[model samples]
Target chain A: MKKQRNLTMAITGFVMLLVLHGTAYGLSDVFKENIYVPEKLAPTDSVLKVAVGEKAPDFTLPSVHHGKISLSQFIGKKNVVISFVPAAWTPVCSDQWPGYNIVKDLFDENDAILLGITADNIPTLFAWTNQMGELWFPVLSDFWPHGGTASKYGVLRSDGTTERAIFVIDKKGYIRYIDVHNINKRPPLESIMSELKKLNQ
Target chain B: MKKYFVVVMGIVLCLVVSGSSLAFDTKPPAVGDVFPEITFSIPGESDYRTYLGLSKGEYFSIQDIKAKVVVVEVLSMYCPHCQREAPRVNQVYDLIEKDPSLRGKIKLIGIAAGNSTYEKKVFRERYGVPFPLFEDADFELHDILGGVRTPYFIGVRIDSGVPRVFYSKLGGFESADEFLRMMIELSGL
Candidate 1:
């Protein structure tokens, strides 16, 4: 009877260990936070106002980090890649700039600087971009005139937001490549890297 | 009589534990479905040590892993959610390393969706991840895996060179210990 009791105790202890081991590891309490942004009712209409091989129209705009940034300031010094997103706090736009944030070395390797342009005001840009860690490039706002810089590049949508576009300008301020992508889709990084390679060559 | 009681009790405990873990459903290659075989490369010898068991600078395919259980993470360097989940994922890796029974039988790897080699390296360095991270620049792995969201996880059980998906989660797991336990329970390891 004592042997049977010991057996029962040993089995109970082993099962208890298993149960304790399982329960000791609790579920994480840090749930993912959701960011709220309004969705667009209609697809943006693409209208190309500028073409490659032409001189890029220069503009000065207020930056979220700095007081002001001028496109022509880097023309004689380094190549520039102007990234235009539709609006602030939206899903695709939020992910786009952060993706570029990790690739600062890629831009540095090709002797180029990235300028993120959006039609939203400074305060909105500040709140939206702060969610995306630290960004190495300047995020410029074209808010006062309502996408004036985006309009000059022919990427302004009818909804007052800019189309998802990329403009690669050479050191001499000539447009080398222009990609006006669908507002819903992300422009792949490989395409931009290849364009930058062309500029280096 | 005592031996019989011990055997019966152990069997009952096993059934109860495994039954509770099977209640959750996730995206495909659901439990028992064959995990697709994919090929990818990683830089340096250290990253390959715990993953493919290959020497430094050698490319490895899914079939090369000798472990009975494998965990694959589909992530993107530019994804904010993935960036936030990195440290937790690292903790899972550490848990697996520390556990004696799971050390050699289970392995963890990451596939960086839409990230280039340079970008993957930057993420690894920034997050201090010790697992082997591979670049899916063209998103071939992403397309093959049915376009799951960032920080997605897939756990597989290997049976004679054929991998069957045993566990899948869309987002980050709550905790490393819980995740490790789930993987072990689902894989029946």
Candidate 2:
């Protein structure tokens, strides 16, 4: 009778595993609905201090998964795309990073590395990005100095949040394109790709 | 015995949570319901516009599609699951096209939640997607259809000019052939 019971338990376990695999496994690993959304804010809240053709500012920042990454590390090797999102969990920010996740090859084709920056700290960024599935690029935190890098580029808003912006820097550390986009909208991917193509040329 | 019980309980909890996310969270469109009227922008490409049988228009509604059955895929370019499901979906599209009986009778399109035109374009190019895809940059189309998760599939039959849904499910499918069979069977083709 004990042997029969053990067999029954083993069978039950196998069935449960199959059910989980079909319905639940890996599907829940990423974030889903139930995000807390806030009302719309000003279109473009900050002015950019950096301009096209200016030398891009170099900084060292902590990443969610990787250790400290410096802008100078890729200065002479790869073009860099600095994406400054306003906040985590908000409407545009959540979708923007995931969109970039799909086009890693495009960035690589142009010899560019994208660095996603926001004022939210490590834990916040970790929890936020954890739901975005697997991102291909390093997501750095500008939290310690409270939007310090954003301020350096003049993207820090009056309310301490960064502007939804894009800055494309060439291999020689010169700013090639700057789009301090409207805070309420995402900078279209075509514009970014167009700018990256210029760096390739 | 206690350890075994804990493991079982953990698995059960995961199912319960995942179940809610599957469909009930936002009351997604289900079988036997009238699919919402989604006015999609006609793709600028001539091939896509011709595939949908749309002519000279900024937008066209579901009723405008010239097919007996339309397969609508609600996806997000940012969604890893959607990215993984893209190839399988493309296979389904190919199988449907090769089957002469299903050709012109069935069509496939994608509605990308929170994806802009440019983002949607990148997804199409990256996946080599053959079907026409529309952007739902603000989630308007998603909310109208009941805010479901990515990789959601809805099979609608428009035989008599009104779209009546026959299949609606969240998450991904197992096999391309199996999925195509289901769509064909459910639409009564």
Which candidate ranks first by DockQ, i.e. highest?
2
Q: What is the TM-score (0 to 1) of chain A in model 1? A: 0.80
Error of 1 at B112 (Å): 2.7
Question: Residue by residue across B68-136, what tens digits does model 1's lDDT show?
Answer: 888999887778778888999999989888888778788888988767776777788888988888887
Off by over 4 Å in 2: A1-30, B1-30, B41-60, B114-117, B136-149
Candidate 2: tens digits of C-alpha lDDT, residues A1-201:
566557556756655554333221112113566454555577787778899999998999999999899999998899999999998877667767877887888899999999999999999999999878778899999997899999999999998889999999999999999998977666778899999998777
Instruction: Candidate 1: list runs displaced more than 4 Å.
Output: A1-44, B1-50, B53-64, B87-101, B115-147, B158-188
Task: Go through the candidates in order and give each one's C-alpha lDDT.
Answer: 0.77, 0.82
Per-residue C-alpha lDDT of model 2 across residues B51-86, encoded as one tens digit per residue: 888897788888799898999998877777788899
**What TM value does the first chain of each candidate achieve?**
0.80, 0.83
Residue A146, model 1: lDDT of 85
lDDT of 1 by residue, A1-201 (tens): 777768677766665554333211001112123433343324457577778999999899999998799988998899999999988766567667887887788899999999999999999988888878778999999998988888888888888889888999999999999988867666877788889999988
CAPRI-style class, candidate 1: incorrect
